[model samples]
Target: MAVLTYREALNDALREEMERDDSIFIIGEEVGEYDGAYKVTKGLLDQFGEWRVRDAPIAELGFAGLGVGAAMAGLRPIVEFMTWNFALLAIDEVVNAAAKMFQMSGGQYNVPIVFRGPGGAALQLAAQHSQSPEPWYSYVPGLKVIAPATAKDAKGLLKSAVRDNDPVVFIESEIMYNLVRDEVPEEEYLTPIGKAEVKREGSDVTVVCHSKMVHQALAAARVLEKEDIDVEVLDLRTVRPLDVGAIVASVKKTNRAVVAEEGWPMCNVGAQVVDDIQREAFDSLDAPVARVNGLDVPMPYAKNLEKLATPNADHVAAAVRHVCYAD
Candidate 1:
């Protein structure tokens, strides 16, 4: 096992996948000659050449549509959007063609393609670029939505997404790419989609979250432990086909649940999880479930305002305690 940053793990996955499969190639803005906006694809162009590691024009819709077409024609194409905020330009291709192709074709065709790039809030990137669009993509059928919170999960899930038979949206956090470091096995591995990982175990309350919010939940759990309030933190790695069973079981033991997410509370993935828990484990819950989510407003450019919009460790801890001890 070697310690690697989230960015390095992603690079390793792409490098290995391209080497193992001839049909697999990367196409995106600044991916080839520029080595990626985050340098995750650095040195790939020099090794794989222009044909495999291509730098497409800044037309997200055009290249996304091209990637969908290529995947339909039996080529495995990975389309990077620079940032998922820009992916709005290619919504027609991603939501319509890529997501609906296999089902529309009556299963005769499987678009083995991966649409990836940095996603979520970073610094003071304001409203447009700071939006978390994973829920939007997860709403569509035929598209697999994945967001990895750890270096190991990032590497394993990317490989799994690339090799899958359907379209996959592999979202990475811009902030976490260089910040978090963890041990990643050198040998190839794949974390199956739709599985939930228990990052920490406790018997008081369950905190379910994804991506960077998972880290926030874990940190909150640590603080809660100091206050004698045990908390279980679950990382829902994949958004679609969410692992409801894992969440139910955790809530069953703890008798309390707090859903944490980076996005707004309304129509968010956290709401879905909380609904599922109530439906499945209503009797087991000792208190009403709580949702710790971003403020229901556009992210602001100011650092303090941005911090207030996003759920932090303290916010998660408070939510857990409120849910656990509420009368």
Candidate 2:
């Protein structure tokens, strides 16, 4: 087993997939010559040549539309937006064209495309670049949305997304790209889509989270262990087609749950989880479900304010304690 940074894991997935299939190509701003805004695609251009690994102008909408057209024309394209914030410019391509292609054509055409890049708040990046759009993309019916939290998941999920026949939104958090390291399999592997992985097992409380918040939940679980409060952490690898069974079973065992998310509190991913739990696992719960979410405000430019706005270990721990000991 070799340890890899989140960025390297993603790059490895892209490189391996491209080598295995000639139809797959990567196109985005600075993805080739610049090696990506975060260097996730470094050295790819040289190995694959310009035809396969391309650099596009700073036009997300233009390149994204081109990628969609290419996918419909029998090529698999991995389009990278520098950050998800820039993806707003290409919303029509993603929400309408890519997501609706199969149904719109009555199954005559399939868009095997992957639109990915850093998502969520990056410190000091300010409001323009700091929002999390996973919830927005998950709302669309035909798209597969994946937000991987660990190095292993990053590689495995990206590989699966590339091979699928439908368009996928692969989200990676900028904060986790270089900070987290984990053991990744030497041989390539693809984690199944629509599955959840339980990072830690507990019998008292279930903590459902994804992406960077998964780490926060795990950290909080570690601290709660010292107080004899066991917390089960469920990493919902794919937000859409969420693994509701895994979450329900965990809640059944614990009889309590605290959903954690990095986005705003209103109408967020966490809200959806709580809704599903109440609908499917109502009798199994012993207390009201609690949600730990980022403050409902634009991410601030100041480091301190930004830190305060995002959900962290302390907030997670507090929520877990509240739910576990609820009267």
Candidate 3:
């Protein structure tokens, strides 16, 4: 096992996958010469050359469409958006073209593409750049949404996304690029998409979250431990085709659930999880499922206000307490 930061694990995965597959290529702004906006593609350009590590113009819609076309033409393309906020410009391609190609073609074409980059707020990036748009893509039927929290999941799930025959939206947290670390397997591996991980086990309550919120939930679990409240932390590594079985199982075991996210509450990923719990594990639930989500208003620019807008460990803990009736 080798300890690595979230960005390093992603770089390793990209490098290894490109080495294994001749058809795989990366295309995005600053991906080649600049080594990715967050340096996740650092060293890849030199290793694979300009032909594979193609640098693209700052046109998300155009480049994203090109990636979709490339996928239709039998090449696997990884498209980086710099930040997911920029990806809003390319949603038509991602949602209309890439996602619908296989079905539109009547199963004759498969868009083996991965659209990735940092998501959610970082420091004082404010409203324009700090949105968590996972649910936007996850709502689509043909797209697979993945938001990995740890370095290991980031590496494994990315490799899997690269190999998947469908469109994938892989979101990473900008704040966690250098902050999150984990010991990854030295051997090649793939963490299957559509899975949830029980990061911490407890019998009193379950805290369901994805991406960076997993760490927040873990921290909240620690806080609850002092109060004799056992809190289970379940990371929904894959947002689309969510691991409903695992979530239901966790809720059944804990008897209470609190879903958390760095996104808004209305029609968000956590809202879906709340619905799932009520339907699949309604009888098992001891109390109503509660949600801790980013403020409905646009993300604030001030550091203190931003901290308050984004869901954190304190917010998660409070939600857990509400559901567990421990407050």
Candidate 4:
């Protein structure tokens, strides 16, 4: 095992996958010459040359469409959007073409491609740049969505996503890329998609979350521990093929739950989780399922406003307390 940053782990995953499969290639803006927007693709260009590590223009629509076509031709392509906000321009290709191609064509064409990039709010990316689109893609039928919260998950899940035989939306976060570091296994491994991981176990309450919110949930759990409240942190790594079984198991054990997410509350991932919990573990639940969601407003330009809009440890703690009836 080696302690690595989220960026380094992702770099390792891409490198290893490309090395293992000659057909796998990466394409996006500044991916080759500039080494990626967040330097996640650092040194990949020199190692694999410009052909494999390509840098496209500032055109998301054209490049994303091209990648969809390439995937149909039996090449595994990794398409990076500078940010998901930019990927919005290419949603036509992602949702209409890549996502529905296989099933729409009766399995004649499988778009084995991965669309990845930093998503959700950053330090002060402002309204246009700050947004979380996981629910938008996860709502589709043929697409798989994953958001890795740890370096180990960042590496393992990415490898699995790249190798999967379907379209996947691999969402990363600018807030977590370098801020969170952990020991990731050096051996070749794959974290199966559609599985949830219990990050920190407890008995009082279950905290459901993914992406950067997982860090906040962990921090909140630590604080709650001081007051004799045992909080379990459940990371929903894969959003689309959600590990509903894991969620049910956690809720059954804890009997109380709180969901944390960076997205707005309405029709968010948390709502889906809440529905699942109420249906499968309704009798197990001791209290109502509470959620710590992002402030239901467009992201503001001010730094403080941005902070308030994003979910933090304090927000998570309050939600957990509410579920536990300690608020």
Best by lDDT: 4
Model 4 lDDT tens row, 132-229: 99989989989999999999999999999999989999999887888989999879999999999999999999999999999999999999999789
Which 10 successive residues of model 3 have the least lDDT summed? 318-327
List residue ranges in candidate 4 displaced over 4 A: none
- Compute each candidate's TM-score over C-alphas: 0.98, 0.98, 0.99, 0.99
Q: Write the per-residue lDDT of candidate 3 for residues 1-327, one digit (tens) a residue.
A: 999999999999999999999999999999999888899999999999998998998899999999999999999999998999999999999999999999999999989999999999898998898899988999999999999999999999999999999999999988899999999999999999999999998999999999999999999989889999999999999999899999999998988999999998899999999999999999998899898999998988999998888888999899888987777
lDDT of 1 by residue, 129-188 (tens): 998888888889889899999999999999999899899999899999999899999786
- C-alpha RMSD of candidate 1: 1.1
Q: Going through the candidates in order, what is the number of backbone clashes in each?
A: 0, 0, 0, 0
Q: Ten-residue segment with the worst summed lDDT in candidate 1?
A: 318-327
Residue range 89-170, candidate 2, lDDT tens digits = 9999998899999999999899999999999987789999999999999989999999999999999999999999999999
Task: Single out the weakest 10-residue window by summed lDDT for candidate 4.
Answer: 318-327
Which pairs in model 2 have colliding backbones? none
Error of 3 at 208 (Å): 0.7
TM-score of 1: 0.98
Q: Lowest summed-lDDT stretch of 10 residues in model 2?
A: 318-327
For each candidate, what is the lDDT? 0.92, 0.93, 0.93, 0.94
